[model samples]
Target: MAGGLTRYRHLSRSSSHRQALLRNLVTSLVKHEAIHTTWPKAKEAQRLAEKLITLAKRNNETARRKAQGILYTPNLLMSKLFGELRERYAERPGGYTRVLRTEPKDTYSQAPSALLEFVDSPKDVRFVMTAAAVARDLAEGREHTEITQKNVGKVTRYRAGGKGAFEDMVEKVRALDL
Candidate 1:
């Protein structure tokens, strides 16, 4: 069995506990649009999160019930998942979520940690920072630095129009600055 295909990590929990843990993680993700957790949990939850977003896109009764089964607060979060998140990712094909490596949440344990976030939400902090960078250059009458342009490109690629999205984010940042 050494070379046999291994499907998924056990995460050192019973099946029921694992299901509940993942459900809670996905639920929190839907509510807050992001979460920080150990790396393995993030990867496991990412798979479920992707499937749930696909279900949200379907926007049917069956899909709703299936999503409900996976969420802890289905009644409260269903709309966000099926409405805003649904439309956000509509133009795009897949990859509704992103996981980033981060400093360990528990220094004592030294477990690998990551941030799991829904892409293209209303207030994406990463996009905001990238927008701020571009806005600052524009204000100073300077050309877009290579790093700023790269950041903008990364922020806007998944968006329908990269320019529009980046511009919109810059506008939002400016508005906040006022």
Candidate 2:
């Protein structure tokens, strides 16, 4: 009889039910940066979080309200999601989320699930190293303490001896005039 009720009711009628739903989604998203969940729930979370991230990126009053309305999250969580998430994904375009299939778990409900992950593009390490090197050169007026072959972590000396015949051949090569 509820004509416009387009909500996906997961069969619970209490506020606790709804809160638990949101908490589980957020926790899983944070813990693994992804989760294997039902299609409907996964889609809903992806849409909601992406909208929140977009709003956070704008960083204004209207956007703030939009984010607050999207997820029933607290002020602290909302702050982290908005501030830190905005900075983390600043240079990226859309399609920032990914959902993938994984092994099935034997749960009460027989529905299969998929893992959803945030697809952060790889940063250029070479460019980062070059920037760091430039900064060190500027501050110190020289290369920052050139690491000799010894001070760097564990060093493995490469020797040309293995078995008995290999050692004999190496001695013969060492004694060669040519």
Candidate 3:
């Protein structure tokens, strides 16, 4: 019996498979800044991603070489890790990534889903512009328009075509009494 030998989840995978899985996940997370996967996988991947980010924060030759070895394809990912991501997380201490629970893609699968992403990632920027605002800016001959986070809800509403349409459809269905 391997008593008191607690370690990590085996994930029902062989050693090589598990390593490859984590390598791919970490690479994707570093490249895309976010990735969605099953909760267990995301949780496991988070460990590796955080470790890599911590290494990136060091911004030293040894750290860069270590990250390069862990990643599958080194060139692009290593550059990103040593360049943008290193600068992005330089101020912070740790906890580089966050795991957010998301709705499952299929109803039949009970496995929980999650989104693993870097905190304060560029993709998470709240600033959103409505179609109308973009059109107005273009028509005004404005070469550069500043997008601030003030009107996020307005952008969402506009993109969703407003709540009135749904309410009107609900009222029409109620009139049918079916």
Q: Please tell me which predicted candidate would have the highest lDDT against the true structure.
A: 1
Candidate 2 deviant stretches above 4 angstroms: 1-32, 121-178
Instruction: Choose the strongest candidate by TM-score.
Output: 1
In lDDT terms, how accurate is model 2?
0.53
Cα lDDT tens digits, model 2, 35-112, are 678655676567655665677788888987866665544564667666666766676665556565545554677666
* TM-scores, each model vs. reference: 0.82, 0.50, 0.66
> How many angstroms is residue 5 displaced in model 3 relative to the true structure, after the best TM-score fit?
6.1
Q: Which pairs in model 1 have colliding backbones?
A: none
- Candidate number that wins on TM-score, 2 or 3: 3
Comparison by lDDT, 1 against 2, better one: 1
User: Model 3: how large is the Cα RMSD against the reference?
Assistant: 12.2
- Report the lDDT tens digits of candidate 1 across residue range 1-178: 7888878878999999999999999999999999999999999999999999999999999999999999998889998999988988887799888898999999899999998998877556678878898777777789988887887777788776767877887888777767
Q: Candidate 1, TM-score vs. the true structure?
A: 0.82
In order, the Cα lDDT scores of the candidates are 0.88, 0.53, 0.71
The digit string of per-residue lDDT tens for model 3 on 1-178 reads: 6666847777889999999998999999988998988888898999999999899888888998999988988987888988888887776677778887889956898679988887656554221123334334445666434552234343333223334533343345444543
List the candidate numbers ranked by TM-score, top first: 1, 3, 2
